[model samples]
Target: MPFTIKCPLDNLYGMHVFSRLPLHEAKVRYLVEEKVPSMHAMIELRSGEKVRIHFVHPAPPSPTENDESTERDAELVIVARSVADSDEPVIVTGDLNDVAWSPTTRLFRKISGLLDPRVGRGFYSTFHADYRLLRWPLDHLFHSHHFTLTSITRLPSIGSDHFPLLTRVVFAPSQGQDQEPLRPDGDDRSWAQDIAQSKNANKQDVP
Candidate 1:
């Protein structure tokens, strides 16, 4: 399932598919149809288990423009909520341009009820490869509670500004019940709504 946003949109940042699974067995469907330059893929495995995977490259903050990051975050929350509310498992991975500890990230987790595999683990910062002291975990992989972390590692640099992250997770629906789910409080919901309704919520270029 190759995904490409055509001419009028920035075509440089499209998502490509490279799955080893037999194409005939797995069915792929797109979940997001918004103007935002992001991609969401819902795959039904041969076993009939559904998994939603989203690749996002949200807009980075700029000094000249007002911070629309909140709006972008809100849009992502909406997408995540849709998936989380379903029985299918979800995994969202991308360069959010925000730290794991940031308020936006927390709100995302709360609204989506997704688990951060790095919660008890160490920070796997991927940005500013050359700067030792100014790095934070900008690239992230958030999953539903139905999955368990098998291993997560920050791969060596491929001459990019950010290092790649490699994670191995297994779907175990039985273990989901044991995991504590994150829920959004009233204030968080209100904040998300406000952001989503902002006048500057027009589509912007995603990194």
Candidate 2:
């Protein structure tokens, strides 16, 4: 007997998958190219509120000598710019392969205007399941100001390198007005653009 995996919700609602890289069946079996893959979706809630969700698994830091900018950082710059250009609420979640307090993540927050729930909270490390002290927070869930955290938990591991993050947020557009979004200064904007257009930046064909 043979079996196939499917997403019931996506199948029922006809959700589309968008990516910069081709699927596994395409010429590229995996993301061996410079660019990593980003999957995004626009979802409508029962209250008719539209939200954009972006998932990314960016490349980790390599030993190769490159510029100050990294592919992961460049991809983040792209995500930030896209979020800044959109009016709808957005949530970016994934194994970013970087720490929550790193310069890249801070720059990302500034450029995207997205908030991390972990602010004022503890560092919920998610990686290195095998070692106790070697763990660090790698997986993340960032949301726009339109939402507030109702609950967040670091779920038990199911035999993976990283632990799963479970977060519940309540949509409150009114709250967004009170929440001050992070804005990038002139220097910050220049840095982001430099990273995005860096010579070694990933140049995948994303639609």
Candidate 3:
């Protein structure tokens, strides 16, 4: 099934990109409301298997009105939950609003247990067609443990300023043995407290 993801707030005049992917029809899915500029959903195969689709985005951070760090952390929560507790395969695709090399993206990947197909695949910038030096990757498609990446490509620049990314991924067969259940870092109070503290500090300095 072919699907497209675009940031609703992005304009043709702005440096934003749209990501698209074509999946097999055998995958089952239930469309979810766009929680953020991005969206999330559930995907399943004909064998009654299920996977999760997580789209990443948040109301754009206003430098004049909001703390960028806090805004990013808030977005991280949504992205973290999309794959935090799933045993099934996951496909997270969209305009992340952050560059691939950003520290926040690295932390998110580690916390969510997701893998970036673009790593070691060469740097492919997807933003700012008007400024060559300002371009960076804002669009991405990340996968989970249950899937193996086949190929990834950046398509020609579309109407948006950013180039889209297309990734092909296949589900790996299960060993059928009892495995350890997947769980989130809910008990990790230290990290959660640190994030909370950082957000609060940023908010306090805003005024």
Candidate 4:
């Protein structure tokens, strides 16, 4: 089957998604051309079901990167708003550049109303592929309640700074319809609004 690599044009640090399924409405978002871009699209499964997917890799909170994570938080909130608005079964996976248990990531889950499989489960850290002692779960996958996790694992290193993340989810709306997404509180809503409404796009999305 043919596959598509959705990434930022001429940028090495942008987010990338490789999918064999038929993808439509593919678009890439980024605040900085030198930073990882966020890519989103719709994929048609074999059963004719459509799933919305987003891939993100915001700049890390280093002195040379996002500094205090302002852009990172903004980008995440933007994506969260998009996901929350989506009516289709959504799956967002990416190297978020933030820990899974961080406040930003928590807000992302709440704002998006997505379910995290990592809860109750141990932290499946993936960063520092070479140094096991300094690893963190910077990569994550959050999805709608229309599915259930079959398995999620941190795979062996693939020659990158972060270990590969492998996830499998089964679509069974009947089984997951009862699952409730994390509700954002008043404070969470206010912060999410502040980020989403105040942040302006520094770069246009890719076609």
Candidate 5:
């Protein structure tokens, strides 16, 4: 299965790219050239698959004359719903411009219920390799718990400031097919009051 997808970050350097291979089994391809809105797509091997995709970005606060400007890229969210009785796999890969440890990214991982293969796996710097201390891992591949991580690798820079990441993930039969709780229910009113008190305390602490 082959299809074309427009790049969300048009004219930006170091976006993801794809090519066909002859040795592969079944494959669904994505093309990221001159695309828009930073697409998120899922291809079902057959029918009755639950795959959800979302492209996201955080808009910066309004800039002032004294502030520096920056461009924020979109974060792709791909959800692969399990087949009813089949053991086929689902995979999602992309360049998420956000940092791995950012709160927004964490929330995304939680909401999407996707497990990052890079976690517990060693960190490999991908962005700003030239700057030793300032580099960070920006690209990511996240999968559901049903998927087992074979390998995750950071590749050499392709003439771009950010190097690419290649990951091999496989879907395995679930030992126990059960959904985990998303989050515990909390009192919104109490939480708001707590936040307000904390803010006032911080104000008192400030010089």
Candidate 6:
């Protein structure tokens, strides 16, 4: 499981990120529709370096909600492309809706060139807090190669269905120098375009 599972949106307009660091720059970027957006924040560390963070919370596909993964997939594709074009220590994370190992999430990882710390680590599943057996890792955090993972773990539930997650990383530009980013294949490109065009980009076959 590249890492998450699908479900209905109990609170469609819910999700937030907090930081104690000084924000050098920040903005909300829309995906598909203005109401559905992601937060792009640039933080200035004490070392004088800046890390670009993209916090996303695309709605999930369910019988009563999106029903189809079109908008959700397209949102991820849009963010992935934007993150790909950026030249900085980026961290793209949030409740990605789909599972990590799924084709859609894998494509997002490839297109954005981010690295999943959970690649060889445990799942640390975070959904369905009330039922441990039914939980899955629906929430994710993927960062660029510029930083080294200090720690990542799932926090106990705070009365929410999904468990909160906490992670820490230290910037080490040297670590990124020797790392390679993930790249998408032809089929991945075609599928991404099809999904994006089906909604906000250009009109084409639906994925």
Name the top lDDT candidate: 4
Of 1 and 5, the candidate ranking higher by lDDT: 1
Taking the tens digit of each residue's C-alpha lDDT, what string does model 1 give over 1-207? 342322235532344445544222222222222434565556566677767776776656666432556645755666555655666688888888789998888888887788889988899999988888998899999888789999999999899889999999888888766877578899987776676556334223111
Clashing pairs in 5: 6-35, 7-35, 8-38, 50-81
* Candidate with the larger TM-score of 2 and 6: 6
Taking all chains together, the TM-score of candidate 1 against the true structure is 0.79
lDDT of 2 at 24: 27
Q: What is the C-alpha RMSD of each candidate to the true structure, in Å?
A: 4.9, 7.5, 7.9, 2.7, 11.1, 6.5
lDDT of each: 0.68, 0.70, 0.56, 0.79, 0.44, 0.76
On TM-score, who's better, 2 or 3? Answer: 2
Q: Is candidate 1 or candidate 6 better by TM-score?
A: 6
Cα lDDT tens digits, model 5, 1-207, are: 144443434333322323332213222222111222333444342344444333322222245211211222112212211111123343444555567787545544554456677776787768886777898877667655566767888887688777867787544537323534133123432332343343232211111
Residue 161 of model 3 has an lDDT of: 78
lDDT per residue (tens digit) for residues 38-71 in model 6: 6676877878888987777887889876878888
Clashes of each: 0, 0, 1, 1, 4, 6
**Which tens-of-lDDT digit does each residue in 160-207 have in candidate 3?**
677767788777745322222233354543453366456442211110
What is the Å distance of residue 124 in model 5 from its true position? 2.2
- Candidate 1: lDDT over CA atoms? 0.68
Better of 4 and 6 by TM-score: 4
Candidate 3 Cα misplacement greater than 4 A, ranges: 1-37, 46-48, 60-65, 173-189, 196-207
lDDT, ranked from best to worst = 4, 6, 2, 1, 3, 5
TM-scores, each model vs. reference: 0.79, 0.78, 0.66, 0.90, 0.56, 0.87
Residue-level lDDT of model 4, residues 1-207, one tens digit each, is: 475755555544645567778988887656433456777778888899998887777777786755577777877887787677766799888888899878999999998899998888889999889996898889899989989999998888789998888989998888998877778999998887777556563222322
